[model samples]
Structure formats: C-alpha cells, structure tokens
Target: MPAEGVELTPSPQILTKTEILRLANLFLSSGVTKIRLTGGEPTVRKDIEDICLELSNLKGLRTLSMTTNGIALTRKLPRLKDCGLTSLNISVDTLVPAKFEFMTKRRGHEKVMNSINAAIDLGFNPVKVNCVVMRGFNDDGICDFVELTRDKPIDIRFIEFMPFDGNVWNVKKLVPYSEMLDTVMKQFPSLKRDQDHPTDTAKNFTIDGHEGRVSFITSMTEHFCAGCNRLRLLADGNFKVCLFGPSELAVSMAEYGSGSCLLLD
Candidate 1:
C-alpha cells in the first residue's frame, strides 16, 4: 500500500470519519485482520490522526499501518502513534541530493531525511525505507543507502522500477534483482536472507550480525501476479483490483448518498 495519488482530483473530497469507520467495520466482519491507509501522501490529509484513531478502535483489526513519502511525518507521527500506528514504510529513491531531485521532481531531500530521523526519535521502531531502483539513474546509490542504515534498525528495500500511470517503461532502465543483490553482496560479505516474513514483496536479508536488513522487489523482472491480496481505492472512490490490470470499479458516492455504499460483503 503506497500513498502517492490521494489528492488526484481537484479539491478532493476525503472520505469522512463516518465512512472510514463503516468501511473498517465491514472489513472486520469479513475477517480481515490488517488495514493500511495509503495515498499520494497520507500525512497531507488534514485529519489523518482522527482517521487512525477511529480505525484503531475497530474490534478485529489486529494491525494498522501507513505508507508515506516521509515528507510530513515530523509533525504527524506522534499523533499517529498514539492512535495505534505500529509500523511505517517511507519512500526514498536516492541519498544523493541531485539525483533525488531528478527522480521525484521535488527538492526536499533534507526535509525527508529530517522526517526519517524524527520518526525514529518518536519511537517508530523497525522503520522501513523504500528505494525504487532505476538503471542509469540512482542505481549507483544502492550501496550508499544500505550503508546508511547497516548498523541501525532500519530495513532498506530496493524496488525494481515498474511502469505505472501509463509511463513509458523500458528494460534498459531496470536493474534486475540479481544485479541488485550482487551490488550489495560485493560490499557486505555477511549478509544473509531472513526467512521470517516469507510473504513480503522484497526478499528479506540481513547483515549477519547487524540489525539492519535489505530487500529487493522484482515486480517487473519477475511478476508476483499470484499471491497478491490487496485493493486500492482512489480518492475519487474508484476501486482498483489490480495495480497492473485494466479492470476498474467506480462507485459514485453521490448516487449512494454516503460512504455506506462502499461496504463489501
């Protein structure tokens, strides 16, 4: 779950607290144990803390988390933690300031780094960093990113760049999974795979005696089309069943009169 397109529509209408609560209840009734809130940037939402608090009180939801770009966590993390946010996944493409600017089209490397530090200080244990590996771009920064958190508790994951939003995707721009592992292994001889979280997207591995871990997501090079159990709801209320598929289900809130119409049995 990534929060990158939460504010797609002009003056987007955020799902109200009542609607969020109802949706949580519906999922719980269906025996779903985990729920993640994602957006183009979830922390940008005005009442994010309120939504987290409401979802935390749900009966059967055992885990609650969010995926953000780490731009606004400095001010919102404490409140989110108090409301039962146990884990966080932050997106970071490159450590080099210039490359980062080119990748995200934003000049906030310092701000993002500050946010990561603030989240760790605020007790976001086991914080994870997501880096999308693009060939001929930030692929050189893989070792630097791994070294930054090698002795810390952070989990750094290398994601193979994929085509989304109909962007032009090319194999030449993709750094394969084998190449990514080779790059890391050349520097850290003690790294080994961690088998605890088997279903995770990235293949989990750790520096033998260190607290930090590294992973690789082979979405394009190797597809995990099966065993993917997830759903995406756009800010405009369109439900996307597959991130790569063309199928879409659009539910008009105006027709249903409220958020209750989104309930799934």
Candidate 2:
C-alpha cells in the first residue's frame, strides 16, 4: 500500500514507457499471470494510459486490474479501457460526503461516484467498490452502499478496518463479520453466500434476483495469510511481501540484476 502523507515529488522522474515494459516482460516471464497497479493513488500518475497499454500487450498475462481511490477515474476510464484494463476496485468508504472527506482527507466522494458510473458505462465487468468499515466512522453507510449497487453489476465489498499507518485502531471500531452479515440479511432476507470463488478475506454474499453482490472482508477477525499471492513493488522499488507482514526486501535494478523475487517463506 502507498504510504499516506508523503511529500509528493514534482520531478519528471516517473517511470518511462520502456522501463515499465521491461518490468512487465520480466514479471510475465516469471510465470506471473495477473498484474494490478496500486499506489497512494495510481490514477494521479501522468501518462498512465501508456503504461497500461504496454502491460496489456504482454504475452501470457491473464488479468490486468487496478485499485484506485477513483478520484481521477471518471475522466480516464474510457482511455484506460481501451488500453486493456479489464476490471477496477474503487475505494469508497461512505456515501455521506462529510464522513468520506474526513476519512480520506480529501473531497472526492462525488467524483468517486461518477467514476463508478463511468466505469460501468465503459463495460468494465464486475466493477468492485471497496469500502473500509470502521465501527463508528462509516459503518452506518453499509446498507446504503449495498442498496446503491443492488440494481447494478458492481460488487460492493465491506473491508474490516485494520491497524496501519500508525492510526489509533480500536478493536471496537471493527465491524465484525457477523454484524455485517446480520445488517445485510435484515435488508435482503434471501441473501446467500457465493461459494464458487472462495476468498478467505471476504465472505461473499449475493441477493436473490440481483445482478450485484456484497462481501465482508474480515481481515482482522479472519486472516488469509497462507493463501496470499501478491508482492507490492513500491514506487522507489522496495518489495513488500504482505500488507500486514513485517518482512521486506529493498532492491534496485542494479543490485538484483533485473528481476523481482518472492522473499517470503
């Protein structure tokens, strides 16, 4: 995950098309199938379309997705789709503007909603809306988020808030998996879990006769560290094994001789 509150570097030292292509080629050759671009906010990067295009063209690559705050997706979804973006996971905490601004420290709730609509309009399948549920922060909007996507094809996932970024994470602030299910079940009495694609972090549920689905990501109450398959490469080239894992390996293009590795046992 991108570190929040870091000073933005205003230089033109961003990754070039050729460098991105090289990195994509290396990962594809290493038997990696899916690639996701994430950051403090990836959409803010200049010329992101070019980077997407290069990755989409890589051989043997099965999936190309992105995780964004959705602040800039509305204006770039079409172009991004053309460049082979298959799916999107947008981070939207609350439907209420005041709470959203307070959580993200930015005013982009309206823009995020527009981006979700734009992504759907662009034919992105299963557009996912990621909502981090904190007990007293935005838990009140869980039902609202679920209702918002009931008629659409989007998937709204309610992620249990975890301790990170040195924030004062109170265990009581976590909306437990049981409570989340209870909330949705009350609204849709016929809601059932989807066992087709089992993901440990999120308990997937779908409403009867609805096109969308809702999920509860109980990361703290339930961990899926064993089956986790992801390696985060920081913008400056640090390798992060797990989101909550402490072990990390920092390398450069020169030291490692041009390849990323899984350092975790």
Candidate 3:
C-alpha cells in the first residue's frame, strides 16, 4: 500500500531457493494442487525464474501463476512462461495514465500497459487484470477496463476495497459486487455466465460478443471465510493464516518436508 510507510528491509530474512522448493514439495505432496506467487511484488526477486522452474518440475503441481504490478513484467514473461508459468494476474486500476499515476503515485502506466499486451502477445491463457475498485477514485473507469476484454482473452476483475492496514480504507470506499455487476451490465447487458468454482474469489461473466471475461470480488459485503484454507506466506518468512488479520505466526521451512507436520490428517 502506497499510503503505508515503505522501507527496504536490511538483511531481510527470507527462505532460500532450497527451502522454498522444500516447502513447495511438502505442500504439493500433501494435497496442495495450485500455487500463485504474490507479493508486495514478487517480480523484485531476482531468482524468481529459477524458483518458477524448480517448482514447475514437480509432477504433482498442477498450475503456477503470479500476481504482479506489470511495471517490470514484460521482459520476464517469456522466460517465466516457458518455465511452467501458466497464467498471470496483473494489477491495473485504470486505463487513464494520469489517473493511474494519481492512484499508484508512479510513472509507469505505459510500461504496465505494454506488459499487459506482452502477456497476451506471449499467449498467456486468460490474462487476469486485478482492479481495486475505490468509489470516487477509479470506479468510473469500470467500463473502460471492460472494453479491453472485447478483443483480448483477458479477465478484468474488480476487487472491492479491502480494509488492510495503512490503506486508509472506509466503508464508503467499498464497491459492492452487486453495484459493480450493475455498472458493467449497463454497458454489457448480454454476458455469458460462468460457473463458480469451489474456491473462486471472483464472480465471473463474459461479454456476449467479446472474447474475454469480467469478475467482481465482493469480500467486504459478503463473507466467505468459513472453511477457507488460505495460508499466506509473508515476505519475511512468516505465515499469515488470515491476510486481513493483525498477527502473524512463525513457520519455518527447515522442517517443512520432513513428514513431521502438526496436522496428521
């Protein structure tokens, strides 16, 4: 979050490649089928491609995807794709460059735009665009985002503003799923509906005459927390069982694949 005080960690404590692979193999062997690499920005990791290749080699691993800001994504996409990167979920709030700069407080909208096109150009299947919908902010650009999906196989996903720390969140900024759907439906009245997956966070629909999909994430207005086994790994080698929660529990990769897990189930 830009509003939060951003600082570079000095001598950061993160798991190495061997440890990461160990953890991955452990989880995969224990019924973890899918994996998506996310971060403050996973692209910042110089060894990301190496990490992708090692994990992709696992026979039990079904898919490998990533959520990135797309600012530095173009040059890395082809290599990552070749190494078992199945799909991409790029964050793009608005099509307008000026507004984008305003929201992200960065000067890389053009680069991000090119990155999106690059993913599509490189034949990335179903490229996802994660747009955080904030009312009186980037909400007006909803139709513009939908327009991109007309010719491309992109999935424009509208995520409601979540109450994360340092994000200056408020109920007024929450863009409900119903309202998001209504806004898009006004422009695209005839869209094909997609069946919901058991663990899908997005409510998906496709433009009737277009080649892509659109989805809305309504976590704020609706609760989907029960029985969700979402265990997130933080940047500094900690496990956050619930991402919105304040506390983080320590988890070590040292004993990850030693068959000594607490849950014997």
Candidate 4:
C-alpha cells in the first residue's frame, strides 16, 4: 500500500474452518484439484497446519500448495510437509539485506533464505522463489536470482508488477518480460528454453546442465489472457474467477447455501 492510502481496517469477517473445508470440497468434484492456501500472511494463522492437514485429506485433490512470505516457515514447514503439503512459492524481492529491508520494511531476509533451503531439503518439488521485478527497485538482482538455479534445484520466477486495489503501482517501475529475458540470455548464454506446460503461468527455461529452472511471469507486457485458467478465493469468504476484474458475484460461505455463482465459459 502507498503512504497516502487509507488506514488498514481489521477485517473480522474471514471464513470459518468448516467453511474453508466445505468450500474446498465443493470445488473438488468440479475438477478443481489444486487448493493453494495464502493470506496477508498465512503462517500467522494458528490453525494453518491443521488447514493443510484437512485439505490434504480431500479425496480428489491432486495438490495442496502455498505462497508465503516464509517468516514462520522454519518452525512450521516440517509439519506442513508431513501433512501432505505439496510445494511452496516463497517471495523475496532483493538479495541485499539493506535493500530487502528498504523494500519490505522487514528484517527477516535471512529467515526467508533459510525457509527456501529448508523447503528444498524437505523434498518440496521445484521450490519456487517469486521475485516481483520492478525497474528501479529490485530489478538489479534479476541475474542474481537466476544464478540460484544454476546449482540447486530451485525454480526462480521473475514476476511482472501488477495493479490491484490498495497496491501502489507505478507504471515507470514496470519491467517488461522481454527485458528480463534479454538480461538473462546476455549473461548466461548456456540457458535454453524448456518445454512449456499449457496451464503454467510462467514461461520456463533451464541451463545446459543446471539442476534448477527459470521462468518469466509476463502478466503485463505480454499478457497470457488467452490461456488463463485461474480462480481465487479471498480471505473474507468471497471468491472470483478472475484476479484483475472488479470484485463481483460473491457466494456467502459463512452460511452454506449455494447456487451457481460462477459462469463457466
């Protein structure tokens, strides 16, 4: 959020435990096989481990993943892994400690690095590191992030900055997908494009013999709208088929009575 935005209100309207599981189960039959638990900070939830445990038990679900800041993963990841947590996407923008603090206003950069290593050791397939690429900000670390994929099996993803409510988006800060690729290909001439998975949001690649991989999530300059297949559930029980569209067609998960809330195209 920008400094000029309104004060953050405490939303006391999140869904209950039953509602989350119920919602998860409801979609399982509809071919929604993956459920990713996220939050303003999901690890802050006291019941996150239990949530993962329950969702992992859902019969038809193929994957249960999470995207976290990784502040609390050092202690919780082992249990989360045992409870059938499939993978993780950890967010860290800058490699420099000073810049990390300047960007996130937090001092837990080391913890995030620890969590990334810990996930790799614990067998989280392709432990992904998400870097939101901004032109004058953490963009300098693009190659540095890509270097991680050379030896280890971590998948480093360069994400384009996106505009959402309350987020302070600067058009000048945007680094297009082409720029990121050009920068990497210039430094690492051995890198070659990998075969793509149709539903994968990121365009992936790998080096000649590197254990890991790299990707560009080109949501801005080269939008992948034509191949999009996504749905999102908000913290407050409301859900949406599209992440960019204005909030609409909310189903009240607090009280479970539902009709077709989303139109399948």
Question: TM per model?
Answer: 0.87, 0.88, 0.91, 0.91
lDDT of 1 by residue, 58-140 (tens): 88878787888887787788889999887788898988888878777678888888877777787776788889898888898
Clashes of each: 6, 1, 0, 0
| Model 1: colliding residue pairs | 3-39, 3-40, 4-39, 4-40, 5-40, 6-40
Off by over 4 Å in 1: 1-7, 10-14, 196-198, 251-265
Which candidate number has the best TM-score? 3
Q: How far off is model 2, as Cα RMSD? A: 3.9
Clashes of 4: 0
The C-alpha stretches of model 3 lying farther than 4 A from their native spots are: 252-265
Per-candidate local distance difference test = 0.74, 0.77, 0.80, 0.80
Off by over 4 Å in 4: 1-12, 252-265
Q: What local lDDT score does residue 6 receive in model 1, on the 0 to 100 scale?
A: 32
Q: Ten residues in a row with the worst lDDT in model 4?
A: 256-265
Candidate structures ordered by TM-score, highest first = 3, 4, 2, 1
Candidate 2 per-residue C-alpha lDDT over 21-140 given as tens digits, one digit per residue, 9 for 90 to 100: 776677667766777888767787787898888888989777888999998889888999899888789999888888877887778889999998898888876889999888888888
Q: Given candidate 3, what's the lDDT at residue 35?
A: 73
Candidate 3 global lDDT: 0.80
Q: 1-265, model 3: which lDDT tens digit per residue?
A: 5555677655447767786777778777866777778887888888899989998998687778899999999999999998889978999898999998889877899999999999999998699999999999988999999998899989999998898866888899888988988888898998767997666767789777788889887788875676355556666657676656889778665544321111100
